[model samples]
Target: MTRLAGMMAKSAVAPLDRLKILMQSNCPHYSRFNLWSCYRAVLNKEGFLSFYKGNGAAMIRVFPYAAIQYTAYELFRPLMRALMGPHSHIGNFTAGAAAGTVAVTSTYPLDIVRTRLAFQVKGEHVYYGIMNALQKMFHENGWRAYYKGYAATVAGILPYSGSSFYFFDLSKRIMLKYFPKQTTTVNEEKGGRLELSIWAKLICGCLSGVIAQTAAYPVDVIRRRMQLIGMHPAYDHYNTAMWRVGVIVYHEEGMSAFYRGLSLNYVRAIPMVGISFTAFEFFKQLLRIEEHAPTS
Candidate 1:
């Protein structure tokens, strides 16, 4: 009976352990609240339940989106580290940026869907599904439409995801410094995994999120403008190009407009970052994998 119980425990432990490893290594890639936060801000004026606007489709999209992103980063990290060297933070940053780009590229369509859903008003016409949106957007705008905010998105991604990798590592190093005896990993023979407290992880994650968001918020605003389905009609003569978008936003909305949703972004960022980082570190420790976490 004891042996059977032990075997069952081992089986359970294996998947749980694997999950932890997956989160830490790929958390930045998979874990996030960008679309959700955007939706929430729109809904806040209408009602409390607004955040779930496209949640059903979004939830469906998230799994694959996350899966592709995490998997890509996992595959890319080693190549990046090998080529650039593990000790180089620049290598880590580049790996994170590249990983983010790959992940975003794989799931950009879904991201567009999520954004459309978030931007939807109750009576407004919204695309029915991924294919419909793609078709309609292309028919109306051309190929460039699909990648509407690609520049700002890519720019925002670099610092946001890059910082995540940087700060998480920095925080971990800080922890290790203070707690000299703490072990990030454990030998199964001795007992089991060594997990960092949720609080500690959250603090570090929040800090990472804030730093990254601060660096990238202006670009994010421009990205939103570019992504809008009907910005031209509303804003009139606004430039579609990224540099032009920045100029237009500054011209109309002024400098403050570039920081739209700043407070809300931070509110959403703290927990989002915490979840992403915590999940990531947890997974990394569990898997005993070493890789750079993205700044996002």
Candidate 2:
């Protein structure tokens, strides 16, 4: 259920997701970095279907990614709650950060493939498909290539996941406080839990996603740059890729380099997160997962 929800959420914003990757990777063809201009460029060059170029790989990667993430969160949340007590904000953040780290570490290779596949432009196809791309990467750079930007990804995921869960829990608390009637109490075997309206859940999810994505946007750009170390000319230093790319982006492109595709990220993330969390919660209810405070 979590996997299906994640696929549906990502599929809805797959086009924008590709656009964000293109813009962030500093595609050579585009003179500027506006969403509409990039959209038009992709449309003119590769036609409409181009937007979904790497979506197949994305789905394959995201299914296990989402399953691991949500499952890890569920496991960690209860442990944290036991240690930190009920409704601990720190517990929520810690659980989320840990879950994200576990998920990314487990699924980082597919992410590299997904990015490489998405970065391919019309008439410049470097990879034939997912398996071919993986084979080439293995033969060329060996196993290390799969974890090119591991440090950067872990760094970014820490705050990205922490703040996302923190803000989501905070938003729910605020909503329930201000609009008590919109929430109901569910009597579980352990205790009574606050159940929010679907509207509240969606709003909280959207706002949390925007805030967390924005906060970690620069790190995300750096992670992408590092991940493309062998593929991109500017990021050729594989051994010292993370710091080297950071220095290059800072010195060569100034501060804005780290925020190249932020707008598109927000565009993709808002609805994706809104739908993801809402769907997860809906599925949880249907599956009879306990609807307690700090619901994973």
Candidate 3:
């Protein structure tokens, strides 16, 4: 059910994700194009399915990514809470970061395939499909190619996931304090665990998405840039050294360059997180799924 919720959220936001990747990696075809123009270009050129170009690879990565992330958070939060106090935001953040790291490490190579697949321009393709993309990278670029942006991804996930689950747990605490009635009774079996109402979950998710995305976005761009190395001519010379890429982006396009696709990302992320959290909560509540106690 957690995986299902994550899939529901990821599928809905895929197009925006594609566009964000295109813009962030500075896809030459869509260079200097605004959001609408890029959408039109994708629609006109490759039909609707092109909007979900790498969605298959995304699914492959996201299943384990989301499952492990949420599950690990559940497992780690208790440990963190044991170490920190019940109200420690630092505990929540650490659990989230640990979860994100575990998930990313397990599924990162598939992420490279996803980005490379997204880089393909239907007619002029670098990779034709998911399997082909994996095979091509393995054959041509070798094992090291699979982890091009790993360092950046690891660095970025800390804050992104940290804030994400922190806000989630924090919101639960805040809501329980201010709107005690807003929490559901679904977690009674989990030793009086507090579960937020579905609406509360959705709202919490949106706020979390906005803050988390904003915080980690520039690092995301760096990771995307690193992943695109050799996928496009423009990115062929892009540095794999994460810091070097950050420096180059600054030199070439100034600080604003780091946040090129951020607006579109927010457009995608807001609802993405909202739906994901809501779905997870709704399903968990509906099925009476038992999870760890919510931090105080």
Candidate 4:
């Protein structure tokens, strides 16, 4: 269900995701245009299907990524509770961070392939397909190439995942406290677990995503540059050291470079997180998944 939700949400925003990556990676062509102009340019040059260039890889990566993160979160929750008794918020943040770290680390190779595939333009291309990309990367740069931006990814994901789960849980508590009617109980007699209304859940989920994305957007930009540094001349100069990448972008492009493509990120993230959070819960209840769990 979590995988399904991620796929549905991610597929819906693939175009925006690609556009953001283009700008974030400082692609010579697409980065030169504004949002509307970039969209039109891609459509005119590469056709509509170009928007989904790497979506196949994304879907493949996201399925296992979502499954691992959500499952790890659930499995780790009880351990966190035991470790951090009376500090539920802290537990939630740590559990989410751990889950995110595990998921990203596991699926990182595919992430590299997905970025390389998406970073390619119509005429100027490095990789033709998923298998080609994987083969070329390994043959040219060896296995370590797949984890080029691993440090940046983990650095960004810590705060992103921590705040994401924390804020969602916080929002639900607020809703139950002030907007009491907006939530209900599944096993009121036994579990006493509160299930938020769909609308309330969506609001919390979207808001949490926006907050988490903002907090981690800069590292995300760095990660994109690192991931695609060898793919094109535009980003290739940044292929020195990971810290040097940050220093160069800051010194040359100014602080704004760290936030490149952030506006489009918010536009893409809201619906994606909303759907993932809301749809996951809906399916969980429908399938009676994790019914033994204390909360949704």
Instruction: Quantify all predictions' global Cα lDDT against the true fold.
Output: 0.59, 0.82, 0.82, 0.84
Displacement of the residue 199 alpha carbon in candidate 2, Å: 0.9
lDDT of 4 by residue, 53-140 (tens): 8899999998888889888987887799899973578998998899899999999999988888888899898898899998888887
lDDT tens per residue, model 1, 1-296: 22233233333333222222212111122223343443343445445444444444454555555556556666766787798886567776766677777767766666655565545444454576567777888887787667767777888888877777667667766765565245344447435534446567778889988988889888877766566645225433444677887887678657866665566566656765676667666666557674433222
Candidate 4 lDDT (Cα, 0 to 1): 0.84
Q: List runs of model 1 lying over 4 Å from the truth.
A: 1-49, 126-132, 181-195, 229-232, 288-296
What is the Å distance of residue 292 in model 2 from its true position? 3.2
lDDT of 3: 0.82
Order the candidate numbers by TM-score, best to worst.
4, 2, 3, 1
Candidate 4 TM-score, true structure as reference: 0.91
Task: Report each candidate's C-alpha RMSD, comma-separated, in the order given.
Answer: 10.5, 2.8, 2.6, 2.7
Q: Give each model's clash number.
A: 16, 0, 0, 0
Give model 2's clash tally.
Answer: 0
Query: For model 3, what is the alpha-carbon lDDT of residue 2?
Result: 67
Give the candidate number with the greatest lDDT.
4
